[model samples]
Target: MNTKPSSNRRLLAYALVYKYRIIAAILILCCAVVAELGGPYIIKTIIDGHLSLDEGDMTPVLALLGGYLGLLVLAGAANFSQSYLLQSTSLQIIKNMRMDLMRHVQRIPIRYFDNTPIGQIVSRIANDTEAIRDLFMSFMATFIVSILQLAGIYTALFILDYRLALFCLILPPIFVLIMYVHLKYSKGYITIMRARLSDMNATINESIAVMPIVQAFRREKKTLEEFEVLNEDRYVNQVKQFRVFSLSSRNAVGTIGALVTAMVVWYFGGNALDGAIRFGVFYIFIDYLGRIFNPIIGIFDQLTNAQRAFVAADKVFGIMDMEGVEVEDASSAKRPEGAVKFDNVSFGYKDGENVLKGISFEARKGETVALVGHTGSGKSSIMNLLLGFYEPGEGAITIDGRNVANTSKQELRKHMGIVLQDPFLFAGDIKFNVSLYNERISPEQVKQALRDVGASTFVEQLPGGYDEPVVERGSTLSAGQRQLISFARALAFDPAILILDEATASIDSETEGLIQRALKVVSEGRTTFVIAHRLSTIREADQILVLHRGEIVERGNHDTLMALGGRYYKMYQLQKGERVAV
Candidate 1:
């Protein structure tokens, strides 16, 4: 998606559901304008009738006083309602936008995540959304109110005196021209400020996320220095923003002050001096004239805010508009059978550079296929493709002759289970993580899954057992414990196909033995694919494929490959030198 400034149409789409509230706001504005205009008219009535005449008109004067008081009260009530309706609508729109963005992010391909900066994605969801809130609350509603007030004031002024109304109208265009130029110049600078702010936020987020690693290396002082540089850049950008803002404010005030002065001298003075308009009438017009320009100035100031909001909205919408992973597949497509095939698969992130090239493989029902490769030799890519995280760029992958591309990802993945290098657990009880919305799985079944994975041993030792609280990303647990919990969770699902991508690499040999026993139960009667860095982990596999670069360089049973003494043999010898006892 092109990340350019979004137009008004996308913004309007957010407002459609709130149309009634917006219309209500407009009606309230109408009442407010009527009340505001009535105040001056009452003053004119009292001046032209009560003060000019004797005590005979005193009762009518009191009634006019009551009318003026009533109008002011009405204006207050209308303003209050308008504020509530507009603010309510804006907040709801923001809430819906956040939800949509989050859902869209979930549906997008994993490759998008691999290439995009996490900070930028974070900025779009958090900072940019906040900017949009500011625009809607501060600029959009205020701008609308200003326009209505200006229209009402000018109409009232015209009814009172056409020449004075014309004079008021003349100044707006000149001010608008000046405002247009000022906004044009400020737009680039504001864009720069916004980018700097996002960059700063991104840096801070990354630093805080890696705090454990930084502390482990004792790089606190170095990290602080790096943050200080980012902070300084943010400070410089903020200072520049303030300078531009001050200049714009001064220019607006100066221009409006000059116009108001001119209006008072040229129109109000002439009428008052010639007795064509009374003292009260002229003074009231002067008051309304000043009030009218308040909205105009407000409108001008909001232009800057509007530009910032547009850019922020554009970034947010850009993410939403991204081509997410294709989820559309006919319901008629059958659930894939227990067989996996990669037919001349070729894949890559970018043009002309294949990470997995012309690779063909198969895993028959109840077979264990092990993949051994160096880092970045497309082992994980194969796992990703198998799990439907990405689609092959060339050739097809299928399950029992049902092509993956012709199937819904959700449908395809229902039969699959995967344990990653690092497993993630949410902030909840251990039972909740294990259940994962599968209420059909009873506590007894959950216990069995945990027992099968040998996680029940430590889990039962915890204070609350399955009821124990897991903190954010399971930071409260050790790496081995997290993997054990993940294994239990995967087993609870009872998928037809199982994948282990370096699942035991982080655990010690002692835990690995427990996991090996657990895996024996988990892999029974299921198709299993294992990506192993440690050659010993896949020693019992029915078949092994040694990948070099992007192709399968060798494939055979473990004993057969070891006897041949190829790349796999060389890797095994290197592990032996490292004293990895197997």
Candidate 2:
């Protein structure tokens, strides 16, 4: 995409929604410009018409002074109104843009998040949006005012002396060339700087999130060195941008302005001394020339901010442009019957490389199916497909005879609950975490669900019980405690289908025993699928599927699989620490 134009058009579309405010701001800006431009003309009139009149009438001079004061007051009022309207309009647009961006992020598919960093996403939403706000508030305002002021100055200069006005016009094209070169060269640096900033944020977030691991491994020095490298990369790009601005911005423009002014003086000074020009006219031209260059310098300085805003807009738009891969058919919205079936379902994260190869399974209502496999044996991939996080590469998955692929994710997930190995808890009270703040799940139900999962013991022992505050990621709680709470959360939803993905892998034996009892109670009337690493846990499952290399090599209940003495038997013996040949 033509980044600059595309970003500008999108921003303009946002601003145009409040067209009346923009029109009012523009009108006020015009008034302010007129009032400001009148000042130099009034001074010229006083010197040429009043002072040289050789009149002893102090009244005319006093009246001119009063007129000048009124003009200044008018200019001040218009300027204030213009600034307020523009800034308020800008803020409104920013608010709308940010809300839309957040909503878009929510609708994005899970796979996009799998490959994209959270910190990078956060930077676009927070940091980049703020930069865009700067564009509207300061950069756009300064640019418009500078252009208007330059035009006004040239008009006034031409009226006083067309010859000098023509000379003044020559400098703008040169200024344009300087700015063009500066922006062209600085574009690559700004893009690099923004990318490096995202990298730095990602590094910082990763480091902080894994600080405990770093300390445990005694790799703090290595982490710090990695962070320094990212930080230095960003800093280097920033310095390069600064160097580009320094060479092409204010100082360079100022030098050109001075040369133009010196040329105008040499041309006009001789004419004034020779009585070929009025002294007031000469003075007015010089004053207007100075006024012209000031805004030009301001414009060049603001261009740097414009460049940054464009880069930020580019980043923000990139995310907004993504269309979610998961599309829900409206006609397929219906409640599931808890009979989950995967028929020859194959999938892959990358093209031409299947993760689940023709895997087939069925878990009827009120049945518990355990999936046992080594890592990368397609256990989790099966769960992912079942949950609609991914679509199969071949065949189909169905719930109660309805194809899951055609169903809306919201509808498919409405009757489903999941508890991952590492349960994630938001920062809230225990009750809020349990219910996930769903209004439909009452406080009584929340308490009952916690008690069912045997989490109420630890929860009630806390100082505030259900209201006890949970810090970010539930870091204040133990692993088992978090898992128990997650179990309660899933049960509180009263889902028809429950998925326990290695739920007992991280808990202590005593906690696991408590969870096992709780699990039976919760799974009694729901279609449950357990992806288990420990073989002992799934001994009582209605069916156990042993997965190897993305295919189900053995399928039966615990005793039947053990008698067969296949892959499942070998895995079972290996877990029991019994001797088994590879």
Candidate 3:
């Protein structure tokens, strides 16, 4: 999206939601302006009306001086009130905008995240929103006040002398030309700067997350060099932006103002000497001239801020505009009976190349179906489809005779549970991790789940048992311990359909034996699918399907497949260390 009229309109709409606060701030600002404008007028009256008369009227001079001081005090107080109101209102608007952005992001499709960087998404939600907040808190308020002050100054100048007011109009067009040139060149550079910063953040996040790999390979120098390149790119763009600001912002406007001031003196000074102009009017015009140019310079300076804010708004709205996943109403959702079937399904992450081609499978309730394949043989793809993470490219996936493609993921996953190869744990107590903070799951249920998974053996030895603290990603826990907790988590949920994808691969032999016994109890009546690299783990499975490439080549019980002496027989032999000739 372009950072122009449309983006500006959307930003304004965000602020306009708090219209009453803005109105109050504007009213206070006007009062401040009145007090500010009174200062120069009072000084002009003292100099021209009283002091110039040479009547030795000390009383009038003292009264005007006292009034000037009072105006300054009033202006300060009003300015403070206006600033406080505007800042408070801006914060409220920012909070609302951020909340909406976060909610929108949560509803977006998983595919959006697949292609986008986490750092870029974070930058939009955090850094860019903060920039937009600065725009509202400072730039927007300052720009409005500056424009009003300029209008007031121009009105006073015209009332004092029409000729000078007409001459001042020529300077604005010149200022506009300079500002236009600056914006044209600086905007592209600013965009580059923001992009480079996001790239730097992404690199930092990736590097830190994989620090162990980098250190193990001793690649610190290479990583540092890569980071330096991104940093330098951002620095170069910043220098370019600074050059544009120096040439066309306050300094450029100030030069024009000086020339205008010189012209005023030459023309009006001669008129004053001939007594054609009142001294009081001359003083007012000169003071108003300074007032007018200061705000004009401020406006040009704030243009940079305006440019930044608009760019940020464009990025924020870009994400907000993306289409999100559809949500189904809970009242309309149907409960699956744990019987899953994939009928001639074909699929791929991208077009024109299928990962699972015309594959068919069924796992009835109370049955364990095991899938055996190489890494890319589409085992995980089947699970992704079963969980409604992706729809099949052709044919249908159904749970209890209801097509999964037509169902919302929330509804499809309600009765399903999955334990991945690499189990993840959030930072919390053991009980919280097992129950995932689900208040519906009682403390007794959480303890029972741990017992069911044989996790209580090690957990009970910990100081707090179920309440034992778990650090981030459960780093303090052993791999076997983490796996057991994940099993407990799935068991606690009590899903009707359970999937274990290499869930025991990383565990030690002793822990695997324990898990094997636990699995028997947990999979008692639930429909289960197991994807195993270790052939021994699925020996008791009711059905075994051997997949090669994207198609299943053999299917039967362990003894039946072994008797056939085909692919499964060769794989089992290889795992058992029997030398089978290629």
Root mean square deviation (Cα) for candidate 2 = 2.5
Superposed by TM-score, candidate 1 places the C-alpha of residue 166 at a distance from the truth, in angstroms, of 2.3
Please list all clashing residue pairs in model 1, or write none if there are none. none
Q: What are the per-residue Cα lDDT tens digits for candidate 3 across 94-117?
A: 999999899899878776888888
Model 1 agreement with the true structure over 207-237: per-residue lDDT tens digits: 7878889899998898788878867876776
How many residue pairs of model 2 clash at the backbone? 0
lDDT of 2 by residue, 231-307 (tens): 88889988998999999998898888888789888988899878899888998888888898788888888887888
lDDT of each: 0.83, 0.88, 0.87
Q: In candidate 1, where is summed lDDT lowest over 10 consecutive residues?
A: 328-337
The better candidate by lDDT, 1 or 3, is 3
Model 2 local distance difference test score: 0.88
Task: Give the TM-scores of the predictions, in the order they appear.
Answer: 0.93, 0.95, 0.93
